[model samples]
Target: MARSQKQKSVTPTPPSQLDRFDEANSARLGLICVQERIPEDYTRWDIEFLVDDRPSRLTCISPGEYGGVPHGLDGDFATILNVMYLEQGAPESGIVHTTAYQMLQRAGFPDSGQYYQSLQESLDRLKAATYTASESWRDHKRQRWTTVKFNIIERITAETQDGLGFGSGTTLKIQLARPVVESIREKYLKPLDMSFVLSLKRSLTRSLYRVLDAHRYQPSMTAEAAAEFRINLQQWARECKLRETVPARIKRNLESAHKELVERGYLTSVEYEGSRADTVIIYTFGDLPATTPAPEPVIEVVPDAPVTDALRRYGVAPTVARNLVSEFGESLVTQRLEKFEAMLKSGYQARKKSALLVDIIRDQGGKYADPEGYQVEPQRSEANLQAATVAKRMEAEEAQLNHRLQEEFRLLDHSEQAARALTQVRMFVGREVSERTLKTLLSAMTSEQVEPYEVYRAVTRAASELRLADFAHELRYAYGD
Candidate 1:
């Protein structure tokens, strides 16, 4: 049996056709192969399959020129098979054809026939499939994260031997939850502490940017985070008993810094709030000026100084002196004072004349009317009646002229007619037309003109209608030449 035993024919298993295809395709196309479980929030389109122990995932998509499907028909089929294998990584002992068909469908090729298409068509279809699926998955993830919520909790406690209020304590204990503390320490506290301090130095170096910027120097980067920083710093300071007085060295440094800030225009002044010997220096960036110039003094001329002085001193009403001065100038005030004492002694009506004079000044037209010549009672009555008559007559004339000119101009189209109508309007209003008035008249003239004489006639008619014959004559004399 040993002599007759021939060499057993050993058959080597063939390399996976799909694997070979994927390698060719990878070489043909420069696509990266990745393997990761599609996130739950992602759509099915974004899901990709990978071969075990391989960096390349068999994407149902084409790759770069040298990485994916090769240049020919066999190469294209190899690429399709690679995609299928990626779709289903498990090998089938005999179910290879059925598995291939299923993968082809998933990769957007309906059947085996469609899977073995021309290289360009297959690549185009695969690219479209991959892009569409990836986009859908990305959108799904975005929507999912939009609804995600992160929760945080912070527990702050204060322990005081003196039993001060909530915020006031000698010893403070703060316990933050793990997640919240991690987040705060990672995203806010550490970065803010380092960055904010750096930012402060840079800003100071830049001269605080502006006076207002320096005034608003409280950290606005992260308000809550900055508040936490300040609270912690204060607590540390209190524990170290750094309040009431900073270390002498620190104080000297701060003083020097403040002086430099003032010189650089970053700060305006330094103030001390504590006792004279041990003062707390406070720096102000911008403060309003301390003193403003007083307004210039008014120089008032007072006539009859002695009398005016006495009147002012004795509390005599200023209205009386003002009235006397207004009525008889400076001399009247002196004369009034001379007679004032006599009038007061004789009881000869000291205030009666002053009252009459004040009343006369208050009445319209009384200032021009001679008080001694015009009898106040009759003159006021006659003037009222005359004014009423003149106003009524003028109103009637204005109404008549406006009505006549409106009727006449409504029937005319000449520029001169329009000018005349405007002139009539002016006359009705009782204003004299001048060189400026004539220019305005010409502006009102329309561009259309059949004849210049027609314009003259229209102006003449309008002047006659408005009873502004004098204005018409002036216009003729000016323009006729």
Candidate 2:
């Protein structure tokens, strides 16, 4: 979905995107908080995340034209968002200038060809990816859990140099989604050092740190209403939002992050729950939470009084003046106004400055189409029948899977048979069943081993698929279209 071409200089961006903000504490806790690794040959990852004690579920979709998980530079995008916040304050929308090299350095990424490629990859993922959450809590209150699904990066502007690569003054214009703006305004987010999150390699330690950091609303495990909880291996995996990796591997990676964080002083200690030998819980959050917070961003301020005076003297409307501040920033606006003064001194009519200035500002910045305006059309190959057929077939398959699992449900011990049955049903079903459907089934199951469900649905997906496929074949044979 990401498109790129060489440009000599950045086109000025429109002001509609000034309000975008980074994923601060308010936004962070609600996310999956872990990388959904791109499988070896696959470009897409269908991931469902649930924190053990949290009531909501976040299903992350890193969908691209060519499917794949987001790269390390995806982490860098968060830093870029914060940079926008710092540069413009709480702007509604506008462009900021800098090269890819500066962004990599700012995010603690190595400056190199590999990283540059990754930067491009990450931007593609961010632009195309979207997440759906059910009653997901945002803000410090954690009480306003509601449904939301949107991209973190609304739009990006990267210019490629002719013989060189990405160079200086490449304007990155971004628009933060509505929910993000509200969270940024409410100050519901915790601040993390971009360097710290980028420091850890892709593994459980990385995810572990995020999970712990997400809990800084209660810096101490003993703090009231903190998200601290007891969990064995399975629950820990779910809570930390790790992908479907082996339990032993997830535990070891967590232990690795544990040791690293403890040595770095982010954790006072990471220990097993004394009463429950298998349970792991955080006992402390080090001085990380108390670090200096970023200064509030000023939204579209006229930083220069002299420029304001000049605009007022020229008879420009106050609202237009404010919008000019937003579009060009105080410094740039001041510069533009000074240019107007120079034009007047050189003999242009004073009365014409405002109209001329307005026209000039509008013409230079390339108009930006709404970022969310694009969507991928659903595929319709022969195998890809209508969604209704797919659903009907799936229902029939699940019905059969249940009936068969129930026949053998009595053989297993009582840890939980339902979970295993659901898992088995997935095995019997084809991959065509959307990940969203699988996520729903997973949410209903407990942390115990997958079991046969307590009961099977009466309708059968196998019969339905057979009937639909046969009907389609018969029609095709009769009308050779």
Query: What are the RMSD figures for all models against the true structure?
Result: 42.7, 26.1
Residues 47-82 of candidate 1: C-alpha lDDT, one tens digit per residue: 222222222222233334323321122222223333
- What TM-score should be assigned to candidate 2? 0.48
Q: Give the TM-score of candidate 1.
A: 0.15
Expressed as tens digits, the lDDT of each residue in 326-440 for candidate 2 is 6665555554554555555666654576787665455456332212333223343223424576467557655654454465455544433443333333333413344455445
Q: What is the C-alpha lDDT of each candidate?
A: 0.31, 0.48
* Top candidate by lDDT: 2
lDDT of 2: 0.48
Supply the global lDDT for candidate 1. 0.31
Best-fitting candidate, scored by TM-score = 2
Model 2, residue 349: C-alpha shift (Å): 47
